[model samples]
Target chain A: MTGLLVGLGRASLSVFERLGRGHLFLLRILLGLAALVRRPRLLVVQVWSVGVQSLLIIVVAGTFVGMVLALQGYNTLITFGAEQSLGVVVAKSLLRELGPVIAALLFAGRAGSALTAEIGFMKATEQLSAMEMMAVDPVRRIVVPRFVAGIISMPLLAAIFTAVGVLGGHFCGVGLLGVDEGAFWSQMQAKVTLLDDVVNGVMIKSLAFGFVVSWIAVFEGYDAVPTSEGVSAATTRTVVHSSLAILALDFILTGLMFN
Target chain B: MKDPRLMEISVGAFVAIGLAALLLLALKVANLAQFSPPPGYEVKAYFDNIGGLQVRSPVKMGGVLVGRITNIGFDSKRFQAVVTLRISQIYNSIPADTAANIYTAGLLGEQYVGLEAGGDDTSLVAGDEITITQSAVVLEKIIQEFLYSKTTKSASPGS
Candidate 1:
């Protein structure tokens, strides 16, 4: 028991130390430089993988969550005679918390793991070493594009999720639940603000999460040994670290922004 | 060779489409107008407590939403909660004697401002203050009162 506790303590310390390193800042700078350098082909590949591939999942998940929120909120409010607040609950919860956080988690599961595995495989196969021998800056050529794509993609995806979620909530709350249609919309319009909280929170959280994901993927990839086992381990660690970082950062950002 | 430049172009197109979809969704949301309050007339109410009174909370008159709660604040001097409501222009002719009451719909349910129309012929104007009000009857207080009364009744009967 004592050994297990000590091991957990060491692991926690290592995670903090790794996070404190300038990897995230370096990633941001590399992404900026790549944007300036402008490799159109890499950008296109990223756009396909990050944006186009993600659409269907985001739409389906966002809509269902919204519907559930409406159904549950309406049922509870109806008992007390305040059923019209359904719109407010659905809109506020989606815009403020669900949209960005859920989208980021989904993206990490899909894209972050794939990114880590691809790079880890390249390292195991000595492809990265060959690139280094050829005087290529692997960070510039490999990490920067994916990092830039993640930052750009997350916010756009979050926005889509939020919009879809709100529509779904409206469908469930007013159409199915029989909330006064006018009352539902008017409450939404009055409460939901573009600049005040929703947009700002989404933008900041998405960007921070994107950085964490990309940084974890690259760090795990670079550290992988030249073995299949090493590659698998790196991929698993990347997903776990990135997802936890996204959740932790979410709480911190929410406290700072809302409090 | 699968030209990387072609891939980049395709990705850019995809991003543009995604953004367009979002814009379209935004427009759709904007167009789905249901409960918009009418312009020019506003009613303000005061409450002792407004639990679950969220921004965009509905303000109803006889089960019809006439307006929305646009703002909430505390009047430090009076030690009361002030709620600003924007009534629809159609309902501009509310009587000056209208009473606003904060009530809960259910246990652990949302709270809203319920407007009880007055019999007075004089109509309320914009920026009118609703002075006649009933504060929210909190569940805890009601439960405590009920329990206290029950205990006293049982004790007196036994004695």
Candidate 2:
């Protein structure tokens, strides 16, 4: 019993310590934002790596999700003779929930893991230490750009995901299933609003997810033990932790925005 | 990573595509244009009960949407629901004697204001009051009245 209590206390303390360190790391990156703006090339390169490279996966995943939603929604809606509302179901689901959440989950697995691996490798090779020796802040030179790139790329990727998802829903709903085209478009337009559904739901949610995911990735990388095994562990942790963070933040944001 | 120019081009394309997707969502899906009230005129109508009528509900003339409900308020003295409709600028030829009625779209659909035009030469301008109006039909009330009438008739004959 005494051993179990001691173990619990130690675990809790470590968790709190890591949380404090993560916040401090985020603050340091934010403090370097002004310097990062002057050299936009760094951001552009990171965005290319993060956003452009991830486009194909986002689009493909979005299409499949949307198509599946239409198929499932149709089967259910047709029972009540309200299949015309399939568009509303599909669009609202994508814009309000699935688009941001799923996209963020994907981003965590893809870009978040890659960022952790890259930064971990840099630390393992003493690249960050070399930058520190050269009178450059490693946080500013290395971390801030990748963090800012994640923030910028996430919303754009989510928006693209939603758009492609809507098209996929349309193809399954109207083209394949022979639902009325006018009813599909009109119902969606009537229900979904730019301010409430798009801006607040999709954009804001993605932005928050982006911030959380990037912060976790960079912090895990920076805090890792400088060894090959440690780098692998950090990469795995970045994906796991960020994915959990995205889901928790999504619930909170949804309640605040939708309610 | 090697080719900077190619990287820059791809990044720009990605950003452009993202913006384009947002535009499509705003226009094609959300229909942003519907939110912005067109240059138009406002008219008021009073109803006994608006039922499920809500602001931004489409205002139709002859089964065609020409405007939207701008506001809904209550007239305490008259004990009636006052609804304001904003007709689009292009549809300026609505007659002064138009009768506004609250109507449900389908069995379980949203309600809207439908205008039935009368043969009047004069056109309605801003803030014009439409005197002739029909309140929304309430299903519960109709059922209650029907049951009451049937019971009364049966009891009266027996008495």
Candidate 3:
């Protein structure tokens, strides 16, 4: 009984310690972000690496998701003789839920893991130590640019995902299924609104998710042990933790914004 | 130098496309063209049960959307739902005595307010109440009625 109690206490203490460290890490990343205003070149390069590189996957996946949505929604809506609302279902599904959430998940997997691996590699190779010896704050120099790029790129990526998704839905619903093209577009237009669905749901969710994803990526990379296996393990943890965080954050943000 | 220039150009185009995508989304979502519609006037309608009618549901006149429902409230005294609609000034020609109905678009779809023109020449201005209204048809209530009548008819076949 005593041993069990001692073990439980140790677990709780370690959990609290980890939480405290995570909080401090976030604070430093925020400070680093504030310092990024003077480092526009760094920001651009990170955006190129993270955002530009992730574009094709975001677009292709977005289109396929939208196409599937159109096909499935048409089948379901036809049951009640309400096939005319395929556009509304497709648009709302993408904009309110799928667009931001899926984009963030993909970003977490693709860009987030990449950021972790690159920074972890730097740490493993003693580059981070070399930077520290040169009086450079690695957080400010390396982590901040990636974080800022993520925050800006997420919403853009989500918007692109949704737009392409809508077009894909249109293609399936109108082009293949012979759903009236005008009705499909007009019904979608008449229902979805910028202020309610797009700005709050898509834009805000992406921003929050972007911050969380990059923060996890950077923190995992920064805290990694300086060994080859350790760096690889950190990379894996970055992807796993970032993806879970994205999904959990998506749920929380959706409830907060729409509810 | 040339590689960096090409990268920058690609980055620029990427950002531009994303921005363009946002623009298209906003346009489609708002149902606005390049230009926005002018500010509109307001009107009110009452219903026994608004059912699933929501704020921002389109207000249509003769199959054309002229406005949107701005607010939904309860008239406690009359035990009815009060819906306020903001009609665009371009569609200010709705007769003063016109009636409104809460209509679902395509079966099982979103609900909107459909206005039926009365013979009166004087058009409704801001804050006029559309007294005559048909509330939303709740399917459960409809099914209950259908089942009840069927059972009653079967019980008394000669009648």
True contacts kept of each: 0.33, 0.86, 0.64
CA lDDT, every model vs. true structure: 0.77, 0.94, 0.87
Instruction: Tell me the tens digit of each residue's lDDT in model 3 across B56-104.
Output: 7888988888888889999899988999998898887889989999888
User: What are the TM values for chain B, all candidates?
Assistant: 0.77, 0.90, 0.85
TM-score of 3: 0.87
| Model 1 per-residue lDDT tens digits across residues A1-259 | 9999999999999878766654664754465564536675565576567666777788899899999999999889878787887877887787678888898888888888888888888888988889999987677777677767777888778877877888899899888878999878766665555544454656667778877777777677776766999989888988888889888989998898788
Write one digit per residue (lDDT tens) for candidate 2, span A171-244: 99999998899999999999999999999878999999999999999999999989999999999999999999
Candidate 2, which segments miss by more than 4 Å at Cα?
A: B150-159
Candidate 2's clash total is 0
Consecutive 10-residue window with the lowest summed lDDT within model 2 chain A = A29-38
lDDT of 1: 0.77
Q: Which stretches of candidate 1 lie over 4 Å from their true place?
A: A1-37, A56-99, A124-136, A161-197, A200-202, A226-229, A254-259, B1-56, B70-83, B88-91, B103-109, B116-123, B138-159
Better of 2 and 3 by lDDT: 2
lDDT of 3 by residue, A1-259 (tens): 9999999999999879867887798898887777788878888888888998999999999999999999999999888887788899999999999999999999999999899889989998999989999999998999888888888888889999999999999999999998888779878887787877888878888888898888888888888887888888988998888788888887887788778
What lDDT tens digits, residue by residue, belong to model 2 across residues B55-136?
9999999999999999999999999999999999999988999999999998888999999999999999998999999999
